[model samples]
Structures are given as C-alpha cells and as structure tokens.
Target chain A: MESESGDKYAADLSSIREAQMRISSYIHRTPILTAETLNSISGRKLYFKCECFQKGGAFKFRGACNAVFSLDDSQAAKGVVTHSSGNHAAALALAAQLRGIPAYIVIPRNAPNCKVENVIRYGGQIIWSEANMQSREEVATKVLQDTDAVLIHPYNDRRVISGQGSISLELLEQAPNLDTIVVPISGGGLISGVALAAKSINPSIRVFAAEPKGADDAAQSKEAGKIIKLSQTNTIADGLRASLGDLTWPVVRDLVDDIITVEDKEIVEAMRLCYEILKIAVEPSGAIGLAAILSNNFKQDPISKDCRHIGIIISGGNVDLSVLWDSLNK
Target chain B: MESESGDKYAADLSSIREAQMRISSYIHRTPILTAETLNSISGRKLYFKCECFQKGGAFKFRGACNAVFSLDDSQAAKGVVTHSSGNHAAALALAAQLRGIPAYIVIPRNAPNCKVENVIRYGGQIIWSEANMQSREEVATKVLQDTDAVLIHPYNDRRVISGQGSISLELLEQAPNLDTIVVPISGGGLISGVALAAKSINPSIRVFAAEPKGADDAAQSKEAGKIIKLSQTNTIADGLRASLGDLTWPVVRDLVDDIITVEDKEIVEAMRLCYEILKIAVEPSGAIGLAAILSNNFKQDPISKDCRHIGIIISGGNVDLSVLWDSLNK
Candidate 1:
C-alpha cells in the first residue's frame, strides 16, 4: 500500500512532537515492566509499558491534558466539550478543572457508575446521551454549537495524536534498542503517535497494532490500501471497539507497520495472565498487545530478528469490575 | 507472659545482619509504594513495601536464600528440605538450585498448581503429602531423615527470621522517621524479623502484628503469654493461617508493640481496593496491613500522630489465580 503511493501512509509527526512539549509535566512517565515469566515462556524478551497507572486511570489524560491546557484564554473561559464512554470523560474533566476551566462531558447513559462518579468528582458537567455512535456524536455536536465550546475529539485530532505519542517517546527512551512495539489501537491516536515516535527514533523499529478481530477496521483499511468503515463492531475491550477516525486514519495508514487482529477470548486470557502471573490488574484493552504476543498470533507472522527486544503498551486500567467478577466466577 | 517469665523476645539478629551482608547480591530491595488515596482514606501516610515483585514471587526468597547459602559444606552436599503451601516451596527450590544444591519440598496435595509448578520448574523434588498439618509435617520429617537434608522451616528457623528482617531494615532505611509499622503475621517470621529490625533502629517505633481473625493464633498467644495453637483456621489468606512458630512467638510476644486482628471480609475488601486504586495486585494475606489500618484496629484506634509515617510490609505476591478467581467470584 505504501509502495503504491509515496508519503500517503506517513503521519504528520512534527505536530505530535509539539504536543509532547506542551503537556510534558501534567502526566506521569508511566513505567515499563518487562515480564520474566513471559520472556521465559516465549524464549524471547518482552517489555510491557504499563500505562494502566496513568493519571485519571489511563493514557487518555495525556491527550486530554494537552487539548485542555493548549486552549487560548478565551476558549478556556468558554469551556470545552467531548463525548466518551468513561475514561476520556474523567480525563478531560480533570484536565479542564486543573486549568480552571469548565468541562462539559457527554457520557452514554449506560456508562459505568464509577466512571460517571469520577467525572462528577472532578467537577465536570455531565450530559447523558444515548449509548450509540449516532446519538453521542449528534448530542456532542449540538452541545458544541449551542455553547460555542471548543470540541476536543477523543482521537481524530492532531493535538491528541501528538499527546499520545509522548508514551512512545518515553518507552523508546527507556528501552531505546527495542526491536518491535505492539500496541492496542482504538481510533488510531495512540498507535499513530507510537508508530511515529518509534519509527522516527529508529526506522528499523517495527510497529504492530493490536485490535480485536471484531473491530478490525484499521487492519482492513491497511489491507484495502485505504480507510474501510465497519458496520458492526463487537468487542469486550470497549476502548478498542471504535473504527479509525479521519485524522487518525491517514497517520495510522502511513506509519503503522501492521495492524494485527485477535479474538476477544485471547484478550480475556491475557487479562487473566496479567492478573495471575504478572501481578498487575489490567483491563482487557490494556492486554491486547499481550494477547497478540501470548496467543501465538505473532509466531505465524514472525517479527524480524532485529525486533527481538519487543515492547507492548498496556493502554489503561479503568476496568469494569462486574465483568471481571463474572469472568472470575465462571 | 513476658512479665511473668522476664524473658523478652530477642532474635539472633547478628545472624540476620550477616546474612544481609552475604545475600545482598541475591535479593531485590523491593520499592515502597506511598499512596495519597490511602493516606486520605486512612488519615495516615501509608507506606506499602511491595514484595510481590520480589524474585521467587515473594519475600520467601530472602529467607530461602539466607537458609540455603548459610549451609555448611557438608549440609550443602545433602541439600535442603522444607514444607510449605507454595511461596517458600518455590523460593527454597530456586535459591537452592542457584547454589547447585538439590531441594526436597514436601507440599500438600491440595496446594495450587501454579505454586507446585513453580517449585518443580525451580528444580525441586516434590514429595506430595495429604492435605493436613499432621501429614505435611510428618512427610517432611520422614523426607529429612531419609535424605539427611537441612530442614529450613518457613518461619521457625533462626536464619529465616533474620532474612525476613531485611525487609524492615530496608523500609526503615528508606523512611527513617516512621514511628509505627504494621507487619502481617502468619507463622510470624515476617513480623518477628520486622519487630526486631524496627526496635533495634528506634525502640520508640511501635510495631504491630496484623493477623487474620480466622487464624488469630498470634493474637491468642499474645494474650495467653505463650504460644497457642489453632483448632481450625479458615481464611482466604493462605499466607496468614499458620500459628506463630517456635522462633517467632518469643519475639512477637515481647518486642512487638501490639497485635491486631482483622476479619476475612476486611482482608478481601482491602485486596480489592489495592487492586482497584493502586493498580497493584495484592494477595489477601499481603493486604492485611492495609486492612488493619483502614479498619482502625489499633491501640489508640487511630494510627497515632507520632506514627504519622506508617510502614506496611506486603510480604509476598505469589497469588494463586484459581483461588483469586474463586474469591473475586464471590
């Protein structure tokens, strides 16, 4: 796909570097944990960058902080608005509150109570929307126009992509010689940033994007040599269920080496492994990279030997306990 | 008990210090995690010493390494023997193997597969016994006699206590002004070592032994002024079910400031909070110290202001997933 059209697949990573500079201090340099047990089992080294311990319980804070804090004084006074399942809502709320700005979050009515409470606790105004893409987008657009508030899309924003890229910058700095990095892809903000950060540092570094097969829009898009919309997205990893957004799509299309798909069952197994062996509580989405690695999904399509020092990004830890409790009970 | 006998708990601490000097290369000085969330909720700065990330999956490695390396030329040839539910079993096996010594582990047949597999993988020979205290002890004794192996009791041995003492030594060194500490007590090795180390550094540093009410043998013995046995011990905390051992009770009865008992439900709740909030997976036994603090089970009921900087020893992270799966299921 890249060979057919030069520069078509490349991301505008210069903007992402600027985003990193903007929100450097607001978020944590979340630690990377290399799994000895996993390494031993696979006969290969495995480094896990744990973003599950991120502020507001996710890497969403990076993008949110960047988006909110980058606003002009007039915009800050006018407030900001966004729609999210949960993490992004809380992240944006905290981000806005820190800058002494009002945050108007449009959350799905069926969102988890803990998440809704987190947003409210952080002093964000909540607007309940129907739990569907059409309703959420429509309500967010209406709210944006009604109040003239700045709309911060969760992804599909150059600023958000740049903010999320900071994770890769830190990971590569910590494990500079890493050969391959596998990350869970949602709407492409994180992967776009990561792929750019890694490739920019060393062109040899292979980037693998992990997504649930049910939500394999990015993988399909990459194969089809352009964006391909999916009518249906089914996944336990709520974070990775979305199709790639417009701004994110071009970046992911050009930069990401490969978009890999895995079954949700593999993600569950990986989550359990993280809980059992790694002694870390990670959400299903957070384990997608691990799921890809451990499920032997990569073995059939082997990573090059230069990429022997593999790193996988664990995206977030805003896990729903009821689902985990149910799985544990079973 | 100490008043009548005029005998205070004293560890052969010189042995411990010497072991610390020798085994410094083998063990990790696990980091202490401080929590703003916990401090706010508990009204005290809680320093959690995470040993879950320790090699051999727990603080058992410290004791195991001390015991194995302390062996004379003759005993090293004969190898070492121990009976344990799991953590110590694997620790001793790995520690012994590292030194080219064989490990004979007598394990209850009912022990979880994860632990048994860890022990086996660490090159230990497992001698399965019936799932009863009598059978476990009897099988271990027979194995020791048959093999002429050195018996490294999980907690009763002097060297084992000394090894566990290093955790407190490190904690105190890391946070010097801490006025009080909470140590989870099982066979009492961890708390015994902790009490000795804390008192030696600063006699004013109050040390509390946090024991599960289900297996309140430590609490019972503290009141009885002698070692007391449990008729039936049932707790999700497999780590805290044992009574204070021979070497531990004397030390615990005297040097320790107080003994506090928390319930199984409290332990479970504390585990959940640690897993959820701290993004750390803690076994129920490891969560007892936090449980005690959260429940306000203290002498003054509130952790004293003098004990403003409180240290908690999370002794191990060798969690069994099946058990956790069952627990979280409930």
Candidate 2:
C-alpha cells in the first residue's frame, strides 16, 4: 500500500509479486527446516525459513539481486553503490557481480575484516568511510555523485523492500497453515516487506517484529506511534542496530501486529540452541525470533496466544566464530 | 547381495528398498544441500545429503526406526537393547519410544556427557559399561538376557544395514546424476548399505569409503582381503573407530570401489568449513567425505577422475560442543 504522504518509495503486494518473478532464477528458494526440539521448547510448531542457507548467507541477496537486476541497461552501465558493513554489502556486491556490473561499497574502515573480505571476494570496489553511520552515508553519496552509480539504499528503497517481500510469498506457499510469522526488525525492510505480503495474502495471519532489547527503536516507535531514533545502541545482534527507515516505518506500523523485544543474553542462548538443536550456525540477529519466543515476549499477546503454528525467518549466518566461541564458552 | 557364507544377517538391495518403504513416515527425508564455495574448493559438483538434519540428528534413526517398526507386536513387547554412545543410541531410543517400547542402552562410563544425556532424554534406560568394546558387549548381552530385550547391533545386523541403505535410495533420487557416492565407514554398515543399494541401482556409480587415517581398518581390510582389526585406533572422528563387521565386510568387498583415508586435521578443517560455509554443524565423521575430497585422496582413480558430480552423505551431527570448540579454537 502507498504511504499517506504519497512517497514514491512505497511497496505493495503487487510490487513484491513482480519482484519474486524478477529474481526467481537469480536466487535460491531456501528450504524450510523444522526441529522437534524447537517445537517442544516454544510450545508451538515452528517452521524455520532458513535464509541463513541462502546465497551470500542471508536474505539480503533477494533485495540486492532485485535492485541490481531492475536497473535498465544504461542505468546499470553506471553500476550500483551501497553503504553497508554487514550481509547487505556482501549480498549487493555478489548480486552486482552476478549481473556483470560494477559495485562500489562504502564500508566503515573499522568494519570486520571478514565482512570486508567478503565484499572484496565478490569483486566490489571498497571505498573506506568513518565508523559512524553519517560518515558512511556521506561517502556513499559522494561516490554516487562522482561515479553516477545507482544508490541502492539498504532498506529505504522500494525495490529492495519488494524483493525482500518475496520471502513471505514463498513462506506462505511452503507453510500455508502458519498462524503467525515472526521476523527480526533492523532497518525494517525485511519485516515491512514480509508483513505487507503476508497480510495481503492472509489478512488473519499475524506478523510480529522481533527486536533486540539493546537497540529497540522499532519497539519504541510502535509504542509511541511515531519513529524513534536511538542515539546509541548496543547488542550482540549487530545487524539489528539500525533504526527504522522512512519507507519501512509506515509499512511496519500498518501491517505488523506486535513488536517483541529480546535481550542479548536471550539472543545468545537462542543462537546456542539453534547451533545445538538445529545443527545450523545462525548469527545472533538471525536467532532473535527464537529469542523472542524463548523469552516469552509474545506470551500476553492474544494473537500469539492463539497461534499454534509459527514461522521464523532466520535473517543471516555471517557470524564471527570467535564471538560464537566466546558466548558458547561462557 | 547376501554374505558369501549365506549368513542370516545379510542385507541386500531388496531388503533396503523394503526398509525405505517401512520407515518412510518415521524418518525425515533429509535435504540435499549445495554450496558454490564447497564446489569451487573441491573442483567438483558436491551434493551433500545432510543426514545431520535427520531425526535424532543422524542417519542412524532410519535404521533404528526400520528395526523398531519391523518387529512383531509379541517381539516388541519384550523391548530392545543396544550398546552405543553415538547417534545410534539416541536414534534407537527415540525409535523405541515412538513404538511405545522400552529401550535399554549400555553406554561406556567415559562416553561424552552430551551423548549420555541424549539417550536418557529419549527415554532409554542407561546401563553403564567399562570403557572397552568387550565390556560394552558383555553389559549389553547381560541386559538383554536379564530383561528379555532383543539386541539391536549398531552396524552388524541385517535389519540395521538395510535401514541405513535407505539413505542411498533417497540420495540417488535427490541427486540422480551423481557419479560417485562418498560415505564415512566405521563398522561399514552405512557404506555396505549405501554401496549395495547404489551399485544395484547403477553399477557405473563408484562408491568410495572415507575413513580416518588413524582408524584405517577398512582400508587395511580391503588391501589384505580380510577383516583386519586395529590394535588401537585414534582420531577426532570418534564415530569411525569400529572395525568392519562380518556382515558388512562381504558387502563392502563386493560393492565398494575404493577406500580413501583422511587425517584428523583434514577432518577438523572440513568440519570447520561445513560450519562456516555450509552454515551446518557436522561432526568430524560427517565431514570425512569432504576431507577425502580436499586431501586429494582419490585424485588418481579413473572413476574419481571422470566424476564431475559427487554425493557426500553427512553421516551425523551429534558432536560434543566442547570438543568442537577446542578443535576450532586450536
């Protein structure tokens, strides 16, 4: 649905459906995994949409591929540019590479070595930025202006949001009986897209956003009925530190039924459980949905109380092994 | 496909096919995972049959379910017994529990705490045995005699072999164009079952056994044309310590095309790769096939030379976290 402000960057169900067709061949239709242990623990049948197994090890690939492929020939010739030090950087880089297009990544100088290596491996040109978000965006804007490269904003772009919405299309088809879908909200593109597509398909299907307690701008935004920006954020789930974007805020506000917040300790515990029981190495951000469930963050919600079957989107698997080792050791 | 001496405990392709049908609903038809990174590293198209995602976290569940379900109501009434500290113990326990039958597991006193907990959690009665094969066997035998429980040998029995063979049936269907099937060998039940079924389906398909360099009894047995016992075996792949059994030896000799040995270091490296790139937690035993490929153990073989598509059966994921952490840290 279009935003009340009539913003050009608003995604609806039809746009997401188009995106699904556009990126079908370029992306993997990741498998849905189920574990009896996880089901018993949450007291509900949980279907895990394993986006961690997706190409580039995250669901970001869908949005990246869609954004890269949507560019017209002349527009694509100039290449694509993005500012991200997380899965989105690697994903956009790989997506651009797959399309035989140049990708300029504006990454913080202090970004993890592995993440930077991932972008480089995908043939992305790295333009170092200061560690702060403002500096990163400024560098990306300068590069876009200088090189005439297309700016593929991580979450603010309509194409990217629509691309991510394809997940709910596949998820609904995969598990038609799911009563609810729990998604991790970062800049909120994924959850916004998912909520739109899921609600459009099944209005009764509840969509819940799972936020890290350390950086809960989305939760606070839902409570205040307005976007809330955090001055500082701290969470092991580094991916969920971003505040809600303008484009995503409206979608999340309209379509999301509830916002559940889980602490860092809960995220780590859920990550450990995922590794042990699911035999899948999920990043802390990816395990937030499980953390929300385990922490009983949705216990009092009427929709969640009636929910017998739930679908959890595992956001990514680009975890630092040392951090995992430390948490597991502890 | 029967033993040369026509032993009662001999599994053939037909029996395995029957087992597949028998345990179809009881066991998960595990997914086949593929990674571009893994394929590039191995220089071959590798289809990983992830039995790590199987019921009870291993392929052993297929055999256990088949065995438990195959028994007559009268025979099942007396319950089942086995001696194991690996995936088989938990698999059998869960299988028996599904059938509402008692499961008695005789585990070595020094077995990993996690494994002991797994068996107990599955509602299996635990009988502590000394840390020796003979003591385990004696304790299991005594338990069977005292409780009138039928013994379900891990890898030596016909029923179990047939059940494990079912994996090949699924694997072949999942990746029908595989030129070679790589399996980890311990007592050789899995390989025997896989080889018999795979060869019976397509004689042109090469079946290779991946064994730990420290526990190369299968390789020695193949070379000597006799079942050779190891004086002492040592490897990070604890699941592959057992020597080839009489029932499985004949099948391996008749059907298996080659035996490839990999070092513990290679196994650990492959295990780490699985965790990192595949986003799956595979035990050292499960990673041996990849280790064999990575170590170039089959580089000279004509069959392997012609093999473009190789199927690797990930044997299990029942790894001790502490052991995995230590190995990864090191």
Candidate 3:
C-alpha cells in the first residue's frame, strides 16, 4: 500500500498503474484468446494474452512507449538511444517515431536484415556495433554522447518494468479468475513486472517463469537464490537468451513462485501447435509459456496439479517463417 | 418491412436473424480486427471479420450447426449426411456430434489426410468414394437411403444459407460504418447470404465477391447474367472451386454488386501478409478477400475508388502448412 517510495530500481503497483494510464492512448489493449481444442489437449483452461498482436508485434512496445513518453521536454528534445537486435529495437524505434523524436538504435552489424529494415522503416537512426555486449554498449554510449540522447536500458529501468507490468493489470481484468500465470523469462523484465503486479493485485495468485532449458539462467537463479549468469547460452528461442538484469533480478527472486525450463524440441512442438491448432503465429519465446505448461515436469509437480485456470502470455510474433519452414522440413 | 415467406430457396434478413438466435449459443461472435499498416498498404481502412476463428476453424460450421439443429425429433434421430472433402465435412461432423446425432460423411478417397483426421476427430462415420463429384454424390445418396438421414447440402439448402447470412449481421454490427464488404465466393452460399443480409440492413452498402482467377465461374456468370458451371476448375484456393448452386445463383445475380478475380500468386502474397503482418494464420481461400482488394481490377474500378471503409471476410483457415511450405520453398 505504501507504493515503495524512494526506491530507484523498484516499480510498485502504483507505478504500473501510472504507466498504464500514461500509455493507454498509445498502445492497443490486445484481446485474450481461448481454444477448446487447446484446452482439452493441455488439460487446462488457458487464456492467452495476445501481446503478439501488440504494437510493433510485441510487448516490448509497452515499455518503450512508457519510457519515451515519460521524458520531460528537455530530455525528449535530445531523443532516445538503445542497443537491441531484437523486438526491443523496433519497438523503441516505433515508439520514438510516434513521439516525433529521433531514436538512435545501436544494432549489431550481424543483426537480421528484417530487424534492420524495421528500425529504418520507423525512421530510427542506426549505429552499427559488433556482435557482442561490450561492443554494443560502447557503441551505444558513443551515440548517446554524440547526440545527447537519454539512454533507455532494455530491461533494467524502472519505467520499463512498470510499463511491462501493465500487461498484468489488463490480463487480470480480461480473465479475472486466473489462478496461475505463466510468462516467458528472457531478461526477466516481463516476468518480474508480471509477478509483482499480479501478486500485488491478488496475493494468492501464483506466477511462474518459463525459460528454455538451453538458456536456463532464470531456473538456475531461482535454485541458487541469486542471479546466475551463463558464459554461453544455446536455444532456438532468440528472444529468451538474455541474462536477468540487476533491477529485475530482485523482483524475480522474491516474487516469482517457480521457473519451468523446457527443451527446444518441446518449444518447437508448441510452436507447431500454435500455428495449426490456435491459428496464431507465435515466436519461439512466445510459445515457451505453452511449452512449459505442457512439460512433464509441470504435470508431475504437486503444486501445479490443481492449477485449472491458467494465463499464458504470448510475448511476440516477429519470427521469420522461412527459417522455421526450412528447419521443420529438415 | 415484410419477411419473405413461403420461399423454399430464399434466405432473407429475418431468416438470418432467426438463425442467429437459434445458433447463438453454439457459434462464436468472432472479433473484427483492424490494422493501420494494412490500411496504409491497401489505401482503404479494412475491417477483418475473423470467421477463420469460428468453430471447426471455418464459417461452414455455422450453416452445418443451423441445419443439424433445425431438424425435428424423428428427423434428428435419423441423423444428417453430406458429401465433401473440405471444411464442410468436418464442420458437419462437429455440428452433428454437438447434437448427439450420427454424421454420415462421404469423403473422396483422395481427400487430404488432415481433412480425414478432422472428420474422424469429430466422430463422423467416413464413407470412402472415388475422387469425383458423381461418385461422392452417389455414395452420399446410398448412405442417406440406408440410414434414412436428411441431406444437408453444403450451400444450396435455405437453412444453410440462412446460417451463413448470420455473418453479415455480426460483421455489420461489429463494423457499423463499412461502406463495402468483399467476401470470397465458393458455391456462392457465403456471398449470397452476405449480400441479402447486408443489402437489407443498408440498401446502399456494396457487396463484392472475391473469386480465384483460375476458378472464375462466378465472374463468368455475372457477365452472362445466368449461372455458368465450370467444366474444370483450377486454383490454389481449394475452397473456391465449387460452382454456384441454383438456390444461391438467384441471390448472387440479383444482389452482388461485382466479382473480382485474383491470381494464385496474389492469394499467396496475401497469405504471406496475413502471417507476417497480421500475425494470423489464414488459408489461401481466407486470404482471397484481401487479395481481391489489392488486385488491379478493384483498384481501377470507378465504383470502388471512393470506398473508404471496407470489410474483408476471412472465410476459413484449414490449410496444411507443410504442403504450403513445400510449394513456397519450391
């Protein structure tokens, strides 16, 4: 009830509410979808919060929009800068374009052509960096210094956490009786925000983080009771390869009930089901939630045996199907 | 203001309204979706009526459910029968299953394995016939005679047309200001019902039929001012190959404003856009409406140049992506 005052790294429920109000007019209040056939297969009433239909085709737009709009007149005048090679780059670019400001995007030189095209399409200024975190951060820092643009970290900022947290508010209102929510954990911004907001709204609601076993940092972190960094990660889920941020790690460790890791084969199976059964195109990270729920580990877990009404957050739909098609055929 | 009475082949607005009331509990009020990027690409504000999300993954379920439930006690006990190798067979099977009655499906032996699985999944009694219309009809006739079952034509029957017409009522209500509606025409059932109901609601509203260029019987019939059956049809849109039936022809001849035929290439392109941009999986038949609007004929038409708000009915989404993936790769 105190709103977590004077906490720079934390985003409380009040902050999330404020972010929702600020970004309400800019983003779509995307619909919640359900399928009986899918329900019968998974043996749970799964309500999919389709952020895949959100602006820029991902939930990243929510945090980007909130961060860009929260700037003051002088801060806004200098523009915004971020280094991302995934949906966040396009989202930030589009959000800045909507606000009539320059977005200096520092993308790796080896980033996908489609992603680069998305940034250009949204009128973002592209600054190329080498394909590594140190090079990316250095390149982004140089751009921020040159343009005097404010830096918006992908998942570490309080504004971004609060923005992503808006999804919980909307999802709860859409499906009020959802006892459990499963969200994909990448940098933990999405799951951290979701866990905090959902638990704040209803203390009894359980939040679970879904992570690809190939990149199971979140699961390791939960088991160790501390943030775990992997030297190398491997997964088909391009979006869920990032390590948890300092700001998000605390929220994840404290609020998230459990982390369910799924294999790449299971994720591919879930993606196939999304295409054939649900008639929805979800990227690998987005389908991981469904994969986690259907995993044998979850089924065998005593705590999850009675979880009837579950919510799955489909994070994004920006995958290039040509690549997926080739892989499937092989 | 009087409802058309004593007409066995006709389905007016009132009939559609009654069918809506009768089948309201069974079918989904599928949402209408809008996309700004799609509007910018097509030069018109498009409202997509997502009947692809309807029961059985197609709008055929509506007509099938209406026909199955309209039967009297003894007729219902005898069961329902149909001959097809498409969404209709699966839809009819599901509808009959819902009513706890037997569904005698006379599917061609050459029908795709996925389609057969769908019918079997819905508990239909599959009867195999040779890969020809005459063979299908003959097998269906035998089944009807043996079981004393009522024949439910996929499109020709009044109950079927009335059920299909319910789409118009829902679409018009969802998008109240749509000045034009483009619907994919197969056996003319869907467009006939849409034209009748849409015109009844708003006399000046334009109804256009989107047909595949390879299977252009509807376009030929419009020019001839009479029904013209195709000797052989060829198109990627398997759903649009059926010729207009006698009952549906009259409605198309009197009410449909125009027919726009698009090539297979355009249909594939629309399907790509539906998957990549709309983030929805639409079959070739379902993508035809969007393809027609993007066609040269529709763009150059003087009547359509001024149309601002348009509604596109995505008919069905039962496509096998493995086959599509092969073709696209090739």
Best by TM-score: 2
Cα lDDT for residue A62, candidate 1: 90
Instruction: List, residue by residue over A214-299, the lDDT tens digit for candidate 3.
Output: 99998998889778898878887888888899889888877788889999888888887777777777888889999999999799
Quality of candidate 3 docking, DockQ = 0.43
Model 2 agreement with the true structure over B135-168: per-residue lDDT tens digits: 9999998998899988999999889999999999
Structure candidate 2, residue pairs in collision? none
Estimate the lDDT of model 3.
Answer: 0.86
Error of 1 at B292 (Å): 0.9
The candidate, 2 or 3, that scores higher on TM-score is 2
> Per-residue CA lDDT of candidate 3, range B79-124, in tens?
9999886788999999999999999999888776766778898899
lDDT preference between candidates 1 and 3, better one:
3
TM-score, structure 3 vs. true: 0.95
Q: Report the lDDT tens digits of candidate 1 across residue range A1-330.
A: 132245434334566677778888777677666556778766678888888777777788898888888888998888999998888888899899889988899998877776787788778999989988789999999999889899988888767777888888899888887889998998888888787777777887888899999989888899997788888788878887677887777767666787778988888878877876667778778989988876655777755344578898988876756643343334
The residue ranges of model 2 lying beyond 4 angstroms of the native Cα positions read A2-9, A322-330, B1-9, B322-330
What's the C-alpha lDDT at position A11 in model 2?
A: 82
lDDT of 2 at A58: 90
Using DockQ, rank the candidates from best to worst. Answer: 2, 3, 1
lDDT of 2 by residue, A1-330 (tens): 555566533788999999999999988898888988888888999999999998888999999999999999999989999998668999999999998999999998766666677788789999999977899989999999999989999998889999999999999999999999999999999998898899889989988899988999998998999999998888878788888888899988777888899878888778877877888878889999988877766776666778889999999887767643444334
Which residue pairs come into collision in candidate 3? none
DockQ of all models, two decimals each: 0.36, 0.45, 0.43
lDDT (Cα, 0-100) at A49 in candidate 2: 93
Ranking by lDDT: 2, 3, 1
